[model samples]
Target chain A: MPNPRLFSLKSDSIPRATIQRLALYVQVLEDLQREGADVISSESLAKACDVNPSQIRKDLAYFGKFGVRGVGYYIQDLIASLKRCLGIDHTWKTVLVGVGNLGRALLNHKEFKLRGFEVIGAFDCDPFKIGEEVSGLEVMCTKRLMEKSHELGVEIGIITTPPERAQRAANHLVEAGIKGILNFAPARITVPEHVVLEYVDFFHHLYSVAFNITLSQQK
Target chain B: MPNPRLFSLKSDSIPRATIQRLALYVQVLEDLQREGADVISSESLAKACDVNPSQIRKDLAYFGKFGVRGVGYYIQDLIASLKRCLGIDHTWKTVLVGVGNLGRALLNHKEFKLRGFEVIGAFDCDPFKIGEEVSGLEVMCTKRLMEKSHELGVEIGIITTPPERAQRAANHLVEAGIKGILNFAPARITVPEHVVLEYVDFFHHLYSVAFNITLSQQK
Candidate 1:
């Protein structure tokens, strides 16, 4: 139940924690819908998502009212509103840089399409990769990244290049006017203030879990 | 500065967010040390890590005093303490399942070694991939996962299989006595409550940035 007032709130006013929680909610609601659950209470949804029930209510309140006091939330309606709120309702055209192993996995990853992200183009510096078709899209040379990205109206850039080349690839993507970037290169890359950059460091995730386990064993 | 009291605190008493921040601090401190910096203030560290200065001080206080009020924190001391706190001071033997493109990327990812994680073994069901040498280790059949993991004293299990096989791979890993798992299959797989599972979904990161950018544009 996203209300009009929630929709009108200033974007900057919303806490980043709330936005992150919304992402979790989107996944949880989608799963609930698939399971044929038409109505879900905040407590049930929180348990399914491994979050606190009160946290769910607080986050949803920021987005607008979505629950009827006693009956809980309508799963389908919540899914649609969360999608609209997260902007996944519209397909985002994304370009992948680097056709290396990680890049190939990304191209073959079907979940992206299911979540409204379409990898429309790919770029690489290797001559062997250029002109090769992967996931039905022909790989282009990095030289054409800026030009091709603009031509295809790509809004998001995914850099799977090596650490040494990540910064250059980021610069090219920024020049191409990408509004957001998901950089898989372990190296950090700088982007303009207007563009959002999120690094996907699989090692970070591994390290987090490993650290916890190590600490527990020490006890 | 990390205090002795912080070191004495039980793992459960420390917040997960604090641990995550410690990981980020490890990276930042390592980078600063390499650049030959001797001392860093909370304010400077916050700017570098994109975190609040007060938050940095609060997190560090949990571990113990490492910084001098006037001169800031000693760079080398901070690095060692963070690494010790994160359990990265000791290497963790890790085994990877699914030697596909993503798995290959993980094996070749040098950051793993730098961060104190050693991928001692790799597993895959594909006959073509099994026995192939990658990043100095030969790929083994998935059937050998449990036996080899036990023999090698592997502490972590990394799953990079397709969504359909992710759960089975996880079960195999759990059976092998892995204390932690980092799954890259883009599918949710359950593990025993004792085991920690972290999912690496590139779409989730992309969605996070996309949502923020969309919200900004709406304003």
Candidate 2:
């Protein structure tokens, strides 16, 4: 059963692809802010990000009016607003459930930490890994995810377990009050209502690159 | 200067996010064909993939129409049509540069082989891995990528080298007549006008998932 209230607040008509670009624009704006860019017009932002100016304006307009017709947008204010819209304004506590090679590499990635996310807990079935510290994030037992996650009020979860364990880990993510899930596992998963699940398929993406490259070459 | 032919073929208007879903739809269609499903509608395909039905229609409209007014699309015919559009009608010989951990993982992945693309050749500067066999693919010296890629007319190049070597590998791809590149390295690599560069920003994607989940859970 879906927690009917989970997605009640967000714009239901916003294309997910637009939501994704919002994240990308936010990244570029964040970078620009670091470089002391005070004001940026749609044209400037689109040029830097290799996007069309109209597309940038359209994507932003989905939420509300943020751009000034004559002056453009304030970098700091737009960043803050985008962050809040994309749901990254506050620190989010989450658990990583794989601890595999990719998972380990991700924990060490500075970008995640910089994006207001903390890999506060990680879990793996391997006995040797329990209680170990990986990239300063504590490794815990897989069985303990529910307990730790609930106590932490984790609303988001990252699942990187093997395809075999992916479904089980996702179930646990749902049970632990996580309404948003980012699954890196290779398998397809089904989720109950009230939860938002995003699936990133590695092999599928690689295959797509291969296919597109082939087509572009053919042309 | 960009090869005018390739430049004219490139359209950045279609969002990469939408292209990704098209790839997913192709896979789902293939699966349906394998399952002996005769005809599939937009809603059926969307339901199978947990996406909106109108999205399937809209994304398909970008290339051309396929849906029947009432009978739906023929599974095999649509699969073939998508394959043609995606440029995967024929198996594309590909090269993987910078045989690092991620490279090795992708090389070892059976999914590529299953999708009609073959790694065929792998290149890296690391002396120890050169001439070694991993994932049933032979590792070659990075220095010879241009020569071999030319001989094979490698159409697609996958860059898994560190951020430092990303540009170098991308240059090699372009010089060797590789029109399509899937870059896994962290840094964005510039390509010649004729080349299509798609960034497989694993770290960026990871950060997005972590950050967005946190944001979505917000009030």
Candidate 3:
């Protein structure tokens, strides 16, 4: 479910860029909260995050006017609002398939957990790891993936399998009732329209950096 | 050094998105060229990639009139221009830091080599992994990263280490004479003015899908 705070904010209008920035702003605020900085102003947040105060104001405007004209926004209120808007307020029970290196790394990673995506179960064909735990999360066999996820109410699936097996993994995720799939495999994948897919290519990233660096040098 | 072709193309004032898409079109065309397709047009190119033909023509306009307006875009000519624009005409030498699952998976990946990025070496701190070969590429100690990289004239560094070590890897890369960094580590990194840094965060992909799904639900 989407955050009501985000819905309440932009009953009028919101730019795509503004919506995307909410994720970044939430991240910065989360860092602040961890640092014990409870009370913050827009100017301060902007300075620390290398963003413009007005831009921050506009981004927050999407959800609603939580900011005071003079006193500034309450830290907890904005954090809670952003958290809801970004779908991090509650726990995100996700399923990860193709538990290879990238998949294992993601499962062991605390970043997603900190952001609210808890990968409750992982899938793999490798018998050696299928019954083991990687950083406290159990590795379930692909055979039991759909049932486990269905019982757990997982709507998001992280696909970290290899390029060759990515399509098969995606098909399984869709069949298992996952509506959102993060395909880290390099090869492009086709999922049903009901399923939203994003490709996170490990090697194409290197290609992009190489492309940009090469372009900038040419100039 | 950067390719002479990319230098000549971007100097003509192409929009960033167009330039990026142009590179992709060139890649697809290269495949078509290999299959002996000489007179391909923008419509076929867009169809192959699921983009719009008008957008393709508009993007190509920035790089001057390469389209015949009737016979379609010249495959050989357009490919040559795109290769130069993206700076992929020359092979790029790259290094990977952090031989963890993510790093080793990439090291074993043969696609990077096929895409024109040669993985000259890999660096990590694991005592057992050092002096070992993965996918035929030797894993070297992070301690010798700078020396070995300079010796090989490596131009790009991919940071796949955990977030805590990501900055350290970037620092080492910068000190080692690398010009660009592609970070798989989930954090922001600071580098000098000359260094071109790009982040390929899997979280961004997740959050992006999350937001889109949320918005569409609202609709």
Score each candidate by Cα lDDT.
0.82, 0.73, 0.76
lDDT of 3 by residue, B52-114 (tens): 988887876665667786798778888777666556667889899998877877777767767
Tens-digit lDDT string for candidate 2 (B1-219): 112232222343555666677778877787777778989877888898778998888877767778789888898888777666665666768799987766776776666766667778999989999989977877988888889988887878899888779999888778888867888776657887677777765434544554444434443
Task: Report the number of backbone clashes for model 2.
Answer: 4
lDDT of 1: 0.82
User: Can you rank all candidates by TM-score, best first?
Assistant: 1, 3, 2
TM-score, model 1 to reference: 0.92
Instruction: After the best TM-score superposition of candidate 2, give how far the Cα of residue B108 lies from its true spot, in angstroms.
Output: 2.8
**Model 2 chain A worst lDDT run, 10 consecutive residues:** A1-10
**TM-score winner between candidates 1 and 3:** 1
Cα-based lDDT at residue B187, candidate 3:
69
The ten-residue window of minimal lDDT in model 3 chain A covers: A4-13
Native contact recovery (fnat) for each candidate is 0.61, 0.20, 0.45
A61-119, model 1: which lDDT tens digit per residue?
Answer: 76677888888889999988888877788788999998998899889877788888889
Q: Estimate each model's TM-score.
A: 0.92, 0.81, 0.85
Local lDDT at A85 for model 3: 74
Model 1 per-residue lDDT at B19: 75
Q: How far is B59's C-alpha from truth in model 3 (Å)?
A: 3.8
The candidate maximizing DockQ is 1
Preferred candidate (lDDT higher): 2 or 3? 3
TM-score of chain B of each: 0.92, 0.88, 0.88
